[model samples]
Target: AEEARQTTQFEPLPKSLFQPLPPFEDLPRPLSPSGASALIDEAKQAVIDTGSPVLDTEAEPGFAVMRGLALHKLLQMLPGIAEAERRDAAARYLKRAGAQWPETERDKALASVATILADSHFDQLFASNSRAEVAVMGRLEVKGKLRSISGKIDRLAVTSGKVSIVDYKTNRPAPATLADVPPAYVLQLALYRALLQPLYPEHEVSAALLFTEAPRLIELPPAVMDNALARLTGA
Candidate 1:
């Protein structure tokens, strides 16, 4: 038995090692936002549900879809650009984004692009801060109910010692009024304020939601914001 065991151990391993490695090249790449959202019956269902305690990683993909659309619109509105040139630029961006989207979602994203451009409020704000210090992907960490909270600020603009935190929304038929805005969104901006206040002591920081679809800018009320901060910090 010892002699037999020694002979088996010395034998060359079988050619079928680990049942052959998977054909990695044949595997599909991770799905894009459009592709993933298409898998759901309703695109809205793809929106990250914030009810879970864990931070919403899935939110970025949908936000990316909206960001692409917002960029296209912002490009068209750049000052001093010829109307034809602006439209062409916006069209190119839309085409690139649409290529990866399902036909249904592509149509919706395209339609929403014009909505932002049509909003007087968005235009006024963008024009006013054309030279403001803009920060994208602003990151912050804060205490939360169950654990620490971390999030990315969509846009941060500081002008003349006044800091404005803007959160963009891509929801269809964006909230018509401040009251229509979601509590979660309001809480998010408040938390951003809490995190940024110490870093910019001299600047007066404020938070607002820029509903890209409705193109409305709704500032958070002082009372509501104070309450959110109190709850977040347990102060």
Candidate 2:
């Protein structure tokens, strides 16, 4: 009856039950902006130490990282302050950060913030009912493959019964279309959507990328996301 049906629904797959689980090491956890940058540098150094064929590490802590961090701080303060106050705060932070930036790069970093603030898309997204630096975690089962997924969403917008996941990027020349988005970014958004959809079954879930450099939002299409999931789990 109801009990037997429930048991069948929750039964583990035979292959999964027999398969060896992954090692109990520290999972690949998301890090803060600065921490992520440092980790990249460390990883590059490790590759260099091993004398592996790795790309040059000449762009560590590049302008994109600096601009993204400054913009993140501005967005965090925007919700709590008036338009004028928000502008003042952004200016102050950029000035402080630029003081430490190299003379050749200081002006470019500060200018990027002004450009972002001026973008209509940037203003609209932040003005929405959103939470910053939100953490998401869930177990995803795709095509019989089960895996644990966790990451910190840059922004989560909840309006009425619709949910939007927003991730910030600092690509110099922002992607012009959904197809232009990096594969890793597309997969990340797909994973976020999967993790969130079940929790808000009644709400429609969607995701987009906000490229800080170009200051625009690119909505991810459902079909593209499905493909990403298929590739992710080799379904």
The whole-model lDDT of each prediction reads: 0.55, 0.65
TM-score of each candidate structure, all chains considered together: 0.54, 0.68
What are the per-model C-alpha RMSD values against the true structure?
A: 13.3, 11.5
Per candidate, the number of residue pairs that clash is 0, 0
Tell me which residue pairs clash in candidate 1: none
Cα lDDT tens digits, model 2, 1-235, are 9999998889666887898998887644442221211212222351112111111134455554665676666666556576666666766777787566666454554455567656776554566477888888777654364556768887887878988888877665677998777666776788888889998999998988877656678999978887776655556
Q: What does candidate 1's lDDT look like per residue over 144-179, in tens digits?
A: 323233455556666788777776665555678887
Error of 1 at 141 (Å): 9.3
Regions of candidate 2 where Cα sits further than 4 Å from its true position: 1-63, 102-124, 142-145
Model 2 score (lDDT): 0.65
Candidate 1 Cα outliers beyond 4 Å, as residue runs: 1-84, 100-120, 123-150
